[model samples]
Target: MNTRKILYQFGYRRCADQDRPSPARHPVIVVGAGPVGLCTAIDLAQRGVSVVLLDDADRIGEGSRGICYAKRTLEILDRLGVAKPCLEKGVTWKLGKVFQRDDQLYAFDLLPEDGHKMPAFINLQQYYLEHALVERAAELPHLDIRWRNKVIGLKRRNDGVTLTVETPEGSYDLDADWVVAADGARSALRGMLGLDFRGEVFEDRFLIADVKMKGDFPPERWFWFDPPFHDGRSALLHKQPDDVWRIDLQLGPDADAKAEQAPERVIPRIRQMLGHDAFTLEWVSVYTFQCRRLERFAHGRVVFAGDAAHQVSPFGARGANSGIQDAENLAWKLALVIRGEAPESLIETYDAERSAAADENIGHSTRSTDFIAPRSAQELRFRDAVLALARHAPFAKRMVNSGRLSMPSTYETPLSTPDADEWSGSVRLGAPLPDAPMRNGHDQTVWLLEALDGEETLIHVPNGGTPPAGRRVLVIGHDLIDQDGFFARRFDATPGSTYLIRPDQHLAARWRHTTPEAIERASRRLKGLDGEHA
Candidate 1:
């Protein structure tokens, strides 16, 4: 009878007619309609703001949670216009393989760098990217969504939030200046604001399935490790396009009858990873989830996005691309503090830059599940001597392309700092500014992240500009002749590279030769403005 009375007996109650005066009032609301509250209510109704959204499930990607999408979450669904219908119904991959244990192999290609912006990942299905973000939040007419509702009480006064939803046309009382909680990971609003999520949990448990195979297997992403059968555990194998497949076993550590993972123990572990090659089933389950976070992600007019502010461990797809980059960094700073045009300490830098990119993506997904399942035995012989020097050099292929993971940044937070160019080598001020290629006025090619779609760009560079007035800046000029030389060796614009980005593109602050009074004090503390800026 603990854990705070079993999370207040899974609270979320609210009803018995409360003082109802709201249908709107700086109305924002949001709260879990999945895919980080429908991409934070279609990026706060494409910044016009006035959202409602809510949801207790009544349509919208019902389960089989977060399939996988990276490549910076398809460049943030191509900056919220829903990435060409999620790349024409996803399932594109360049390559991936990784097995180890007597049948060694280590492929991996994920092509990128040709009109950049996105490539290297996309295998869609988390209810088909929540059916294209609830069909672009049903063509936002100032967005209203609702469905089964259920925010069940929130309160927080002095300027906004009242919540206490419940609908099907019943309990109400909404009033909102803000309230987002892309709810999940047991986040009944971060357990009704008692906060503190913390982490570490892995007594092994996983089974996932979703068969219907016919293998020649090569739609990439394999990852085995001690697999000759489920006898030694670990197996992943995803490919879901039309031929469908998405396994993932590993029930070890006291596998208490996970409802007996049948189909004769999963078609003999897909006949030991494809020896007998016959397949056809569809879906299976057995989760045991754990990998936490949340020690704060704003809590006043209530806030918290994606897995209600962090969950990690779906190994490197970083929980719905870090909850759609925490709803594109809290939808345009909660639509410029509900249109009063900022200043609310810019929502305290969305809990200090997404709680420091959710603790560096939960310490790189708990070190990729402790370097592929190793909890001792001297950390599995130092992860098999770094996978036997990552199978022979090229500095372990750039250390497996720096653990092939992306999107998660920070610049020491308090809305980013570090400027006075002490520039030397490895500058990691809120990393992620990699794509390049250019030319878009009508001569073809593009990608300085396609002019950082829908808001907050300020790139500058090529002798960085003087922006900071209603912010937009994307200037990149420095003659690499606007489009080739591999995007001038990956975004080579050293005429004092600026960058500001953030609209879920990451890198929220940078400067090498920047000063229009430090871009008007980091654009008035990242557009949450209020006075001071010079």
Candidate 2:
């Protein structure tokens, strides 16, 4: 049979499991206990929903992948109460430098704004991040983390989902009101469902090595384009915690992995870059990857998060960060649905919002790849010329700085509700809504984000006087004001700038002035007000 017919047969088999299901009903069954799956399970458990987390691996942190975490990811961890431990355990870097040939000329600092709650970035391995999440999941009584258990089958129906899981001991049948497939790029769940993951795959390969080096290199991310000896390749030297420095070199199209790892092949690059600095190699691998994204994030009852939904080139560290954000967006919506507060359709927005963000990441990473990859002698020459220009030209410096990283995406969709008065620069929808300094209940001032911890916030923008009727209301620039800095810069509130922030801290809506009806409407949409909106 063809692939389509085989899939149709699998679908029928799983549907039979669903139709014959007994009266036992579980809250949620999440497949693949990677960081995304673990995060989803923990978030649901935190919301008081029972969750069963399953993974094929015998233990957490089995995979040696995903080493970088972005600022937005730290915020997601903060929401789950795991960020503090992650910070304590992980190494933080504040500066990044870009180099051309043998000379290093420019540097940029990724410092968190003064008094901001979160840092710019952290370098904790993906396994450590998963381990931290699992620890938190263990504390939540409603959550169950089952390792060495893999999903052999999945079926989606109007009622819910039925899953067939296999263990070393035996195969068992289970049913859930909802299912999330946080499996990686080659998602078995997405494949079984016949969903489309669309994008391009580059043919280039790279070598990443973690080494213990004796060098004068301070803790900073260093990138080299077209260095001596390697005519057309790129290199990254980043220091991880525990004195392990990660070195990445772009191997040529025909470079053999085994040959590249030989002490002769690896040591010279280190010596050339670090100027005869002594170093011992701990681990090495020749890794090749591509950038691609799913055509859709949701198909009926099944949803995809992390690598299952999108894959970006490792250039800008977008893959893991985007996946974590996918979890952040879907977790709350799933909780609301399981709690019977909103329609199951609310989960559909995850596909819409995240797919757009994935596309943006795809573009950014692809551009970074093109600059790093050398196609021909002329092309390599052009790249060298560009880097040489960046050495002396201010415009070239900015161009390289702009491509150094990825940030939170703006919600450009029509589905997104906009802020009242549009202020320029970084505060747009889909951007991070940072906290400004404001007063707390004790009359002592604190950051607005600090003051609004542990609960949802509804800022009331009273115009012509008459406050909206709600307990969650914070009267911005009136009873409450932001005077210190850019706290209310994005809101552009002159007295009346209302915003309803979700528990995940994204702005649900903003208005010049809010009514009881509008506030209730937005709150209900977020599952904060039961089914009142519907």
Candidate 3:
């Protein structure tokens, strides 16, 4: 646990639950205070669910891990009221460059379009993101975040679960109606449940050198395959906040992990890469990654999220972003289930959708890893040829993989109502709604996600028609004023076009010309109240 800066620390406090005759049963119990766990607790607490968040560590700062936060993650953070601090502190970038040796083969824009609030991604230390979530959690009275409270043991029952939590003094028991396992990849809960977390385990290793240097390198993601400085190995460079730069150098499968992380070995590599010794080593570690996950995310009353449910190469930047999405998808459905508004089967969608998402991420990460570290001579030659061809051939640019960047997952589940009418739009029925700038009722310009704001909203361009009953409808010309025609063009919207957006900002259904009855049916179907969605 080497950290350049200690950002957050909390003292251990004895709770009254330890002395209760019967274990205090909470509506929801969240394990691990990492980004995923904190988000799960905050989102549920905001939905008015009583949550108890437990973490083994007394402080947040560790090595600067998982620095790349995607734009979709920031939008989810915005809904939790904590995206401002992250955006303010993190380094923003959308442009990424791919290189073959010393030559730049290609560059890509993650967010080519405009009118979005957040950038393509931000390189912020993991501790900063955790600190922001912890600060936001303190504002919620119902959310109880306990430091040094670790779930040492768990017992699943028919009604719920009883957990044995270990603290400084001793141990205590807790009963929870539902549990969220967001602990890291080495999860204690996953082991306790007898679930297998086996998948692709990469043999090659990489060394992370976090150096503090006052350099003028523009904030962008730069990846090199067979770079001249790293001896025919891959390397990545990213600029972070506070003049800290993150460098990743590929070490072969047989490299000594312990020796490679030492300052004696790491400093020379850094000097060679930068051609200067002015930078001070802030933090260093060697890691071997994998693309693995459990068979399913949901197991009875306990649901797994984050690294606990899935593991992927950090180069893809899918680990933390997908975990945040897990919190969003599970929180809304779990809230509905706990409130008796939706059947217990709603939880099934969480497993189905997130498991599919995990598979997609694992697939991409595996391919990226294979391409970056070719296993055979033929594979190496193919990868090199692709990199060389990418300089001119547009199709070859698609073949070159320097880690396919993180993107939001589009769920293909029964919950989404398939498009009934032939329409021309980039957005799909189950995909997330593309953001656009619009004017609210107060005549203030806001992002479309902000206007949706954690509610099941109906965006209707009025044709002198009223929307469905029992749903919040935002009239395009009235409540939402679309200027520059970005929203209209993106959604293929017309005067009578209608869309049903879920609470998580995903499109549930849409139509060319729809009635109130159809919208109501789609709403029910989205909630698992009707159709095969249940």
Error of 1 at 500 (Å): 10
Clashing pairs in 2: none
lDDT score at residue 314, model 1, on the 0-100 scale: 80
Model 3, span 250-288: residue lDDT tens: 998999999888788998999998989999988899999
> Could you tell me which 10 consecutive residues in candidate 3 have the lowest summed lDDT?
462-471
Candidate 2 versus the native: TM-score? 0.87
Greater lDDT among 2 and 3 belongs to 3
lDDT of each: 0.69, 0.72, 0.90
- The model with the greatest TM-score is 3
Native-vs-model 2 lDDT? 0.72
lDDT of 3 at 53: 96
Ranking by TM-score: 3, 2, 1
Residue 187, candidate 2: alpha-carbon lDDT: 83
Model 2 root-mean-square deviation: 6.7
Q: What are the TM-scores, per candidate, against the unseen true structure?
A: 0.36, 0.87, 0.98
Candidates in descending lDDT order? 3, 2, 1
